[model samples]
Target: MWQHLSSLRARLSLLLVAAGMVGGLILAGVTHWPLPQLLAWLHGGMGQDAAAPTPVTATATTAASVPMSPQDLYVVLAVGLVLLVLAAIWLAGRALDPVSRLLRALEGAVASYRDGDFSFSIAANRRDELGKLIRMHNELGHTLREQRQHLAQRELLLDTVVQNTPVALVLTDASGRVAYANIASRHLFNEGRSLAGLDFAELLAEAPQVLRQAVESGEDALLTVDMDGSDETFHLSQRAFRLQGRPHRLHSFRRMTRELSRQEVATWKRVIRVISHELNNSLAPISSLAHSGAELARRGDVDRLPGVFATIGERARHLHGFIAGYASFAKLPAPRPVAVEWAGFLEGLSLHCRYRLASAAPERAGWFDAAQIEQVLINLIKNAHEAGGPDDEVTLSIHDGGNETRVEVSDRGPGMSETVLAQALLPFYSTKRAGTGLGLALAREIIEAHGGRVLLANREGGGLRVTLLLPTAKAPPRG
Candidate 1:
């Protein structure tokens, strides 16, 4: 009778009948002796106050004399208890049906949620507290589902950005071991090998100073490190941050060598074209002039001879100067770095240039060959002046760019077209009628020799901005 108590209905029925039987026994025992029986027993036990007793026969109540023994009483009580238990079980099953359904729904919903499926919803059949709770649980599932989807999409977008960016991206754990690497980082720092599972220190072995402070003390720093003897120079931006519940450092490397090389090649091609065109022009005229003077002298018509010689001399000098410029460009020597103050440098530039110069120089000095760097600066300034209108201002600004010195020369001239800007540094590709097209090209060569680069871009409103980046003494010197 007590075995199947798992159901709420069974347990309630069992408890109810057991309580009724216990109460009935207590009440029966208390009133078992009536007033007369109790008084008689007391009289016999106390042995007191008996007046002359009348001879009266004791009589029992009609109900007490009925044909009933202790067995009959037991049987009747058992029958009643069984009936009560059955009735109680039936009522409890009906009353607790809603609770049973809710429990089943909870079980199923939890199972679905565990499997990452949030579509399961518990039904709210009754307008009661349980119904409201069920509705809230369903809403929770929907909200969680939406949030999960949004988070996944965001993670995908972040991964795409990290993978596709040209700057090398490296993620390392608190122990400074590589945890993740983007494609650019793998190609740049890992010798095209996968960067995962490798130690960051191993990759930076030759250049441990690249992120020494950051690795040891979780500091932020900018570093220039060369990897695998590639001509490229990478500026490493490193810092510590939290990722995946643990501390990690992110290293982003931006390569600048390839860009500079492309600029240099374009400059050389332009130079060749300009040299060819100018040489052909000067040589053709000189050849014709020489022939004309010879034929005229043979015919005894020598009155124009002085003019012819003068013309020939002028053409020869022009050609000589053009060729000499080409030779100088071709024979550019390696830079001999020296320390120079910005004020003195700007003063010397002022004497050479007629355009008004604006200036901002860094407090710390630069490590560069003064003459070669001055050549580059002079070329850029001249280009800026020519690109701007007569009234336009030529501005020179310099800033300490962490690991390098950034110098910008901006002018207010009409900006170059895409086609012109793309090939502006090529030798023969010049907009001016008499331009050799070697100015920017030669400047690039010199700056590159000093382990720097030239960047030419159009100004926001109009005109051109030429930028030069030179490594400072603090930065590891480049080739």
Candidate 2:
């Protein structure tokens, strides 16, 4: 209690009491005089007669009879001091009210900053020191909010670039742990798996040496990597810099496989078109001459004309077959679908193309242009036979794929290499010297036209497998 007596509240109370005493003294001094005497003094200053002393004498005699004691004066002073003390307390609370409100606002702003929120700000309207302090804090909050917004925009732009770009990007920390990976990185390097916190070395396990050298050196390096059993080349770019005061690496991988494949296919198509045009121009005259010579020989010249006609006829037939192969591939017709039973279709396929059936046909039927699909199957079966030995039997199987029917033709031939299979369906890409490379291409075009797909790959048992996927004839189940 004694310690608190010297506190601000206590000191303020004492000062209030002291002020009351000083005010009491001033009031006492002014009021203790006879009222009549004071009134007469005022009248005397107004030029009234000396007879005004009569009222002063009466008032003086009355005050003399009721003179106040020291104790009475002390009582009045004490009462005035108590009123002043109460007034001081009321005034003190009013003054401290604003302080409490300002303190709360300050505390809230500080907490918001700690929580990474800079949107809240204090509004100070008063022209005082505390108001000035609030305005300064509000300025700081505004600056922080602007900075937060700027940073968010930058982060959004970076994520968009990283995820949407065709190039694969991998970001790592100083210790080579993966910190960030873009969508392409997940696809090409991680097989669509999470890359965060994974070791950089493990993420690039497919081409560890290539990636390591690229990361260590601050330069772009072009390298070829084996992906999906094919050698795919990529242009790699690397840069090392500090992020948030820590060293980091950004590695970019751009694939060149599609671009190179496009260029190669474009060149081949141009060459094939040129050769086909020139051959057609020369074939018409040769066919006409051969037919004229054959007619002449059949008419009468039977000595050397018989052998000449036979040679010309043989050459013309070969030429016709060669030209027909190119023309049929180049001028494929759209599918005109007709419902065909699987059993009859397989019988026709076997009789025409000599493909031995390996698996029994499923009960389901197929809907496709019989002629176009037959051509697809015949080409596949013929290629299978030609690719294999004379005794090797090409096997045919049918798989009911619910939505699509899969017809697989397997041959026990020397299987194509990884590189060859990748380009097998490309036009003018063939293993055989005499092949126009149009068989697989035409098959693909026909299958795709029917809203189906064609896939060619090596079979598991050392042979080539050609799969033709066509839409099934069966209706879909109602949802």
Off by over 4 Å in 1: 1-111, 114-274, 360-366, 398-404, 418-434, 474-479
Q: By lDDT, who's the top model here?
A: 2
Model 2, 1-479: lDDT tens digits are 76567344566577667666766654554446443344435545554454454555555544324444565456546655665566667656755776789999989989999999999888767555566778898999999999999999999998898798899899999999989998998887777898899898765566557666765677897778766678888898888899999999998889988998898789677657746754665576567767777787778656766666666566667667767877877677767777788899888876787767878888866788888888888888888888864434688888888888888988888989999889888776677855667789888888888878888888776788899888875333111
If scored against the real structure, what TM-score would every candidate get? Answer: 0.53, 0.43
lDDT of each: 0.74, 0.76
In candidate 2, clashing pairs total 0
Please give the range of 10 consecutive residues that has the lowest summed lDDT in model 1. 58-67
Candidate 1 residue 403 C-alpha distance from true site, Å: 5.5
